[model samples]
Structure formats: C-alpha cells, structure tokens
Target: EADIYQTPRYLVIGTGKKITLECSQTMGHDKMYWYQQDPGMELHLIHYSYGVNSTEKGDLSSESTVSRIRTEHFPLTLESARPSHTSQYLCASSDNPLEQYFGPGTRLTVT
Candidate 1:
C-alpha cells in the first residue's frame, strides 16, 4: 500500500465557507480517485483521474472540483461550501486497477 495522507483530518466550517481537502501519496501512483460518504452510507465516487491533467467526473454528482497537477497530489475543493456538503471525503490511488491505497479521509462538517 502507498503512503497516503489527508490534511486537517477533521474540519468544521460555517455555511458558505470555502475549503480544500488535500490528498497526497508518496508512491507516485498515476490513477487517483475521490469518493464521498455520509455517515453509515455507501461511498459515492465524485472524481477521478488517470494521470496529471486527466480528470473525470465520477458516478456521483458533486459541487466540488478536483485538480491533478502532479502524480502524487490530488486536491478536492468546495468553492462555496454548504451544509449539504458535509461528508467524509476519501482519496485513493492505485497502480493496479484492482488494488488501491486510501488516505485516512477528511471528515467535514458544514454548519
């Protein structure tokens, strides 16, 4: 498994707050994914990429955006956060499609 990390592991912000959830890995995987999950719910894929500058939206629709400028970093940003955006954001990267390493996850609360 790759060494993956997410900054500000837990966060609480007021409505309309702008926030960025950072994800990074040291193994330099070329494929990355972002998934969101509400407490006790199944994860929903919101974004993914195969490589730098190759971004694609996932199964779940989201108000957030992601960028992949480097192979090791993938950041998700909510330009104007709202209460409905509260959830756990998970970042995963893989060298093999069948196996992926995941970050600890960012638990966000928009109040």
Candidate 2:
C-alpha cells in the first residue's frame, strides 16, 4: 500500500510570505507527483519526479518548485505567496497506475 503524508494540512498567510509543502511516502515509489486542485474542480498536474535526483515540471503552469533528492520524499516551495496562488496541493506516488496513492493535501490560502 502507498503510505503518503503531507505536513501543515492547512495554511493561511499574507501576500509575500514563502511556503513549502512537504510530502513523503513509505511505499518507496520512484514516481512522485504534485497536483494543484481547487474546490469542486478538476486537478492539474504541476510537478513530477521520475526518481531520485530527477524532476520535471508538469503540464500546468505554477509558481511552485519541487525537488526529489530521496526516493520517498518530494517537497515543493514557493518563493513568494500571492492571493492567486491559494489552492489545495496534493502529493502522490506510484509504482504503477493501479498502485498509485495520494496524500491528504495541503490547503493554502494567501491573503
């Protein structure tokens, strides 16, 4: 089973503060991904990693950046926060399509 976790399940900050959304998985999956979601809306892929030391920006445009230095961890950071950046970010890892698992997301609200 995929065991994934995210810290600071919810966040509220001003327009200029920086933030990092943390994600970790215990299933040892090499493929990790980050997705941005909005309430009652579709999800958009923002970043992904194939394995350790390998990372790629996803199809959607985002102000956040991610790193994959370990097989079980992928953390994303934003240099500066803005009201337009508020949303839910989900972390996921998978060994295969059928084995994919998602972390409980981090909800961010920038004022």
Candidate 3:
C-alpha cells in the first residue's frame, strides 16, 4: 500500500474561494511532488520538493503554490478558486527515482 495520504478526497466550492489540499507521507521520503491531471489529458508535474526548505517549480505552470517546511508534509494552496480550477490533484513521494507512492487524489471543482 502507498504510504502517501491526501485529505478531503473530494471538494466542491464556488468561484473565488480559497482552498488548500493536504498531502502527507509517512515513509519519511524526502522527495515529494504534486501533479495536476484532467480525465483524458496528460499528467503535469506542477511542483516538487527535494527536502525541507528545498522547492522547485516544475515545467508545468500552475496558479497553485506549495511549501515543504517539514520533510513529511507538502501542502498545496490555491488563493482563489475558479471554474477552471476543476481538476484532479495527485501527490506522490519517492525514496528512489524508479518508484513512487501515490496518494488518493483530491478532486476539486470550482463552480
């Protein structure tokens, strides 16, 4: 089973609402990442953190932001949700480059 976990598995809200998606890994993995995905589109790596105080923006542009103050936690925040924000957000943690543990994705919808 995956060691990663994401809270509020699903969310729905009106436009302009602020939201945070929480992801945590208990395996003590130092590498964590977040990806944005659509039902039929490709996975886009939006953010990643190598360890505490180490964060880098991925090739994909995103309105959301993430922080990694603690090695086990990487939370993503959206200042203002919009209709276009509706999508699936996936979190992952890895100890090695070849394998990763994925969390139960959070599905967000901004009506």
Candidate 4:
C-alpha cells in the first residue's frame, strides 16, 4: 500500500471559505502530485513537486495551490473556495516506473 494520506475524507463548506487539504507520504519519494477528479472521471493534475522547496503547477489550471517543504508532506490550499471548486482531491507520489499510489482523497462540496 502507498504511504500517503489525506484529511477530512470529506468536507462540506460554504462558499468563499478558505480551506487546506492535507497530503503526506512516508515512502521517501522525491516526487508528489495533487490531482483534481470528479466522479467517474479522469484525474487532472493541478500541482506537483519534485522535492523539498520545489513546487510547480500542473498542466491543468486550478484555483488551488500546493507546497512541498518537508520531504514527507505536501499540502494544497484554496484561498477562497467556491462551488466550482467542489471536487475530489487526490494525492499521489512515485519514485520511478512504479505506478503512483493514491490516497482515499478529500471530497469537498461547497454550498
């Protein structure tokens, strides 16, 4: 199993609220990524990092941001969330050709 985790398993919040989705891994991987996915859909990469102090936005445009400070931690933040931002946030990490492992995910619903 992957050593990654995400908090709140689920979240329901009002519009315009600031929220942070936590992600962490214990696999000692230097690469981590955050992907946004809706039900029965393909995941869209929104943020990723190569290692500590190295972060970058992914191919997809997103209102969320991420940071990689500690080797085992990568957290995503939304400055002001909206209904449009409601989706499942999946965290994953990989070291090489091995498949990426995903967390249970944080399902956010804005109302």
Number of clashes found in candidate 1: 0
What does candidate 3's lDDT look like per residue over 5-105, in tens digits? 99889999999999999999999999999999998888899999999999889889999999999999999999999999899999999989999889999
Output the better candidate (1/2) by lDDT.
Answer: 1
TM-score of each model, in listed order: 0.97, 0.96, 0.97, 0.96
Candidates in order have lDDT scores of 0.94, 0.93, 0.94, 0.92
Candidate 1 lDDT tens digits, 1-111 = 559999889999999888999999999899999999899999999999999999999999999999999999999999999999999999999999689898999999999
Once fitted onto the true fold, the runs of candidate 3 whose alpha carbons sit more than 4 angstroms away are none
Local error of candidate 3 at 69, Å? 1.0
Error in Å for residue 70 of model 3: 0.7
Candidate 1 structure, TM-score to reference: 0.97
Candidate 4 lDDT over residue span 1-111, tens digit each: 778999979999999999999998989999999999998999999998999999999989998888888989999999999999999999999888578988989999999
10 residues in a row with least lDDT, candidate 1: 1-10
Q: Work out candidate 2's RMSD over C-alphas.
A: 1.1
On the 0 to 100 scale, the lDDT of residue 15 in model 4 is: 93
Candidate 2's error at 98, in angstroms?
A: 2.3
In terms of lDDT, the poorest run of 10 residues in model 2 is 1-10
Cα lDDT over the full model 2: 0.93
